[model samples]
Target: MRIKYSIPIVFFVALVIIEKENNIISRVSDKLALKQTPQTLVQPSRPASARPKANVSVTSQGKRSSDFMLMKRRLEDYSDYRPAAAAAAAVTSRRKDILLLATTRTGSSFVGEFFNQQGNNMFYLFEPLWHVEKMLTLDTGGTNATAAAKAYRDVLQKLFLCDFSLLESFIDPLPVDHVTASLFRRGSSSSLCGEAVCSPFVKGVFERYHCGNRRCGPLNLTLASETCREKEHRAIKSVRVRQLETLRPLAEDPRLDLKFIQLVRDPRAVLASRMVAFAAKYKNWKQWAADGDVHVDDDEVKKLRSNCNNIRMSAEMGLRQPAWLRGRYMLVRYEDVARFPMRKASQMYKFTGVPFTPQVKAWILKSTQASKEAGGIYSTQKNSTEQVEKWRFKLPFKIVQVVQKVCGPTLKLFGYKFVTSEEMLTDKSISLIEDIL
Candidate 1:
């Protein structure tokens, strides 16, 4: 009986030890499983304050790593970035400079009025180069063409930038502290004569200031420069620049968004008008016309040839759309503008990206519709449609023949029909201007 009882006690003790070992193994397995499980799948049973901070530490480290990576990317991108082109684009998008290029007697002054009358936002300079040309001619006797061109370009670049200091250097009897009454054609630029540059002599009268009238004092170029800077757009009408290619530097300048509008007209009409407008200078031309004998070797004939050649070459260069001139060049015929003033003005304004204000429209209507021209030889007002053909009557057949002989290429290029006789020349029914398109 004692042995049996001892055996049962041993078996029960063994069973109890086995059950305790199984509980310990199960607890170990649960701890291992919790350690291996994803944080999202695990549910904590401990009090919030008693829990381990491992997950919180991991989240803070991960956030710091992510922010560091983002900062490093931004720094690398900035290191490779360039702002030159972006800055240039910003400058061009805001401001525009226009060079209205044409030869004398091409109705350039009239066309210049288009921009000059663009309300107060526009700063227009009419023939500022006239001063440069005159001073250089007087000083050098007009012998140094290359030097003159350089000086002209330099002054123009400065003037476009509203830097009158260089231009003031060219003015005769140099401006005293940038005050000059000697600036050539100062009255022509309405901006120069406006109240900003020149205070009114008689207040509240609304009389436009005239440089010749001497009512307004000497032009304060410092004030002029200030006014120029205030304007949103600047336009310069010049008859001095002979070649379009010479202006490439101005176009390429990052500071200036430059565009060129070349105004051309019938050479025959140009000669006829020049003869009447400049009697003393064109006396030889008038003599040749009267005598019906023109020496092709004469200086006058050579001048005509040179002018035509320059026009043709420049037009060809502009038409080819050279890389530098791309979208920056326009060829406008004076006849076209005269025939359709409003339409042409709108096209020009559109090209320069300026508003074609009601003031311009009203001015065009009044200027083009006048029964007769109101001003002197420099007058813009005219019955423009009639003016287109007026040269046909004023120019003699002999002179016309001479112009045709010397300026054939220019005439054909610009769509001016050659007149075979006086009848054809004078006949209003015969259209001399062919449609350019």
Candidate 2:
């Protein structure tokens, strides 16, 4: 075969290959693997001015690809780092809220405004859900529990929104979501309630509560979750605030923990104030039932009498109050509240997570003193001797005896002494208390 190879045959083969390359020149070049003399390798063209800036630099520490992807996903799902920043903003801005609790005519009006002044972070809610709970209980009582709940919640929403104009008719509606859709709904300020710190989102919840915006606010509280839960439930259900169980719902709210300050007054003084307030509001005793619409059952009448006697008795026993009330709820005597309103209010601040600032003390003195100076609201009128026991003197002896008889035991239980800065004699008050107990 080697001897037989011909130059003409080789020329024919080369000519065939050249013809194939001509058919597809681009692909044919890639296919060729030969290294020949004059083969060109062109350099990439660029502007000479291109250079890395001195200020800009890049550093690299290689992490495993899989680990990085996992971390990126985690960061997306739950990035809690931002909450701290948000809370810092809320605290600095002095935008936040606190729960208020007081029965009717217990100086709620002034008290509400008073708290608003001292608390840089505190927001005022003037009877949010005011009497709506009682009203719903009236309509839905033992009937349709769901309807009652809905009505109660509607009222609560209206209260939060401060839409009192439509409130009268709004509470009677059913299907809350429907009401939500039709009405200018203001969302709840639930989330910011118990959070250890405040945030813009939480602040928004408070801000939107007044005008109209339907949304659930974010809350980041350090309290038990139950407190917020129950508070929302009660707000929806329209439970009366006076009921002891009301505290259960409020305290248990995952959002709120109870730092209760149970403010109490001498029942005698309270009764006197009541009588005076009643007289001011009404014309005479007959109006108590007729115009004022005050009603008394056999049990309530008996209980009222019992309350007075027990109080009187307790006052005689000792000045040191019972441990039951003191520990369970900080006992703030009305007398103490009146005497050093600022100092006592500061005590409340320490308890209720409200900051006890000097400004708070100043605020209490200013607000409370103004009312006292007015000398109209439950005034203890001054006498020539600077001590007017006119109430003690003018109040019928029979009424005193009756009050002593009923509330005397409770008085000792409360740690009060029944006397007028006089002689210490037989403790009839104690004996009376013992009889009742």
Candidate 3:
């Protein structure tokens, strides 16, 4: 009877000790699981075939403790493990889409070269929307502004994604099934003219192919698409995107990390430059300047007012920085860039989160310090400092007053001081540009 009772009590005590040990192990496992990294916790379970088979059996408390420690070590290792390929892919797959948005004759082309000269990693487009504006304005008689804006946004969105199919529809003498040499300002984009798109050149050469030289054949859109895809970044310089607010949908796109640099210039300077660059179109403006009679109510004057209003409104929207435009919209004055090209370029590059490459720096140095202005009206190369005040001498007093009166709000908003006289307009002694902008 003593032996039977003793055996039963010993059995009960052994079972209690085992239960306490199991509870402690379970608690430790729970704490270890809680400490695991989010990636480890969320990672899908390994297949039964892939999982390691347990070879050691727990037969003693000491052995179980050893197993618990092994489990802890494995869990810690799993938490820290990230495949090198995945890490590399995450870094390389990051894409930046930049839009250098501005009106024509606002030094957009010059600023665009900042991105354009970013070497092979960048796929830059120069006024691809010129085709869209040309085709759409003709089709809609320039009255369907809303429709045109939507179309511009759509084409830009697609182009950012490397889809040239939508843009092809707007190309005049429509692409013969996605092939065209007639892409407007094709030579302006170095990527389009470089290898893969235009080839049979010396391998490893960095010099861009000039379309004017006709060294390459017609642009193959398919090749261009592939080249665009291969690139890590895409930049488009456009004067056609009139309103900053119109691009909200693009800023919110899931696939793109898009940024806008809205380049603006003094309206007086812009008008003066337009008068010279677009002589045929601005004949009436030239006459008005000569005659000292700018009909304030004339269609041209009203159009100027409207353009200024649009620019001012867009700028106001960007400055207000609604949720959509936050961290995405940047306002840059053409005057600032002209006065300090390198500094301004650095800021712009930093804003876009791209490296201000040595190549771009060299280009800016060469382009801005040229002895004389090179190329046509669309040329980016010039003595930048001299270029800033060229319009002061060119625009007459009457025209200045006209712009000041019509675009008063715009002038004030952008910190452009209104000149009281021709002397003030031409005076380099008195700085027309305020630092406020």
Candidate 4:
């Protein structure tokens, strides 16, 4: 009698367990089927407006559970998917940044000013890395090109990000004197903070720039990220950056649309111009010093050769640029642009996708007019054919010969030939014989 009772109890318990298992499986299957089915999978019996929406929920131990809670959690935790939408938006709406990579005293400011004056569409930065040059003394002489390039690129990256912290730190407390003033003021364009009106957040930085007292401040300025993002173009002119390879990382970044306008000037003219400026700024070439000794070295000759090397390095780097940067990296001659402002300005504007409006044309004409000064360290003459050809008269024969000997190959590479006599060639010629050459 006892064994018979035990067998019946065991069978009853097993039957109840199986019933619960079947119920659970049925509920799970129904939930999955509903999820996998489209709206057309079933016809509504009632009018569409009156039909009840499908809902799936399960009750276990007095708690309701969602069929896709695990999936929802996984989706929420996966951060990588978020950037896809952001990146797509960035690709469509991001502004293009143009870099005017040039040597010192090459009239880069004049070019930069052209872009800046294009209304709200453009933001221009002038020599943001002159601070870097100051940091790297002449003794260092950019011996480690890679490190120098990296530092220059880093500064540029910061500038593009609209972070003026690095730039502000480099600002000297010195007043905007005749020599150091124009860099702080870029024609009629908006200030670094935008229109020169600074938001409370960036006010301190702008104040530190001493732009208010210096007359470098513009009437309008903003620290709004949207304002920067909304601009169609941003341009930076840097004389400190010598090699284009330094900017490779930035050019390759999908986050940025980086283009280089490698501006070249006549090396002879550059040498002569630099000499005049150096004499005026530094005062008294009578007491020049370099390399820890008071050796009598020609400042113009040293500067020309240095500028030539920089030009060559940049050209070599431009040639090696990845296939992605063909049209983006441009080589514009100052002579060409200065000679025909309307045409060259139009070409440059088109390249950067900025419309060459009537206002822009007028600015170009007025800025390059014979009576107006190009300002900054630029010559006082108009940006005319005369300005391009003026080097012939301004530079002495001996200085011209020295510059040609040093920079002739680069000049020829860029389609500039020496028309002067060969007899003037000297033993002091600075030849282009670097590894890249």
TM-score of each: 0.76, 0.43, 0.76, 0.62
Candidate numbers, best lDDT first, in rank order: 3, 1, 4, 2
lDDT tens digits, residues 1-437, model 3? 99989999999999999999999999999987776432231112235355222232344334324433432342233222234224434665688899998998999999999998999899999999888888877553564678888999999999999999999988877877676757877788888888688845444533332465446666789899999999999999999876777788999998888888888899999999999889998999999988888788888898897798778667666654456766676777899899989988887776666777999999999999887747667778888999888898888898898888877766666667779987888888988776632
Q: How does candidate 4 fare on TM-score?
A: 0.62
Tell how far residue 385 is off in model 1, in angstroms.
Answer: 1.4
Every candidate's lDDT = 0.77, 0.37, 0.78, 0.57
Between candidates 2 and 3, the one scoring higher on TM-score is: 3
- Which 10-residue span in candidate 4 carries the lowest summed lDDT? 61-70
Worst 10 residues of 1 by lDDT: 38-47
Off by over 4 Å in 2: 1-113, 133-240, 280-300, 303-328, 371-375, 378-394, 419-437
Quick one: how many clashes does candidate 1 have?
Answer: 0
> Which ten-residue region of model 3 has the weakest summed lDDT?
37-46
Off-target runs (Cα >4 Å) in candidate 3 are 1-93, 139-143, 199-214
**What is the C-alpha local distance difference test score of candidate 4?**
0.57
Per-residue lDDT of 1-437 in model 2, one digit per residue for the tens?
76467777888999999988788886666566344211211111222145222123332112112222332332233232234234434555332223344333334344444454553334333443533544455542423435544554444443333233334453333223222221121222222233332323434233323322333333222221233332321112111233222233333333333333444444544454455666663243224433434434444446565344332222211122122212223333444455555655665554443455666566565555453245555232211121112235333334444444445443434434454321222223331111110
Residue 202 of model 3: what lDDT?
42
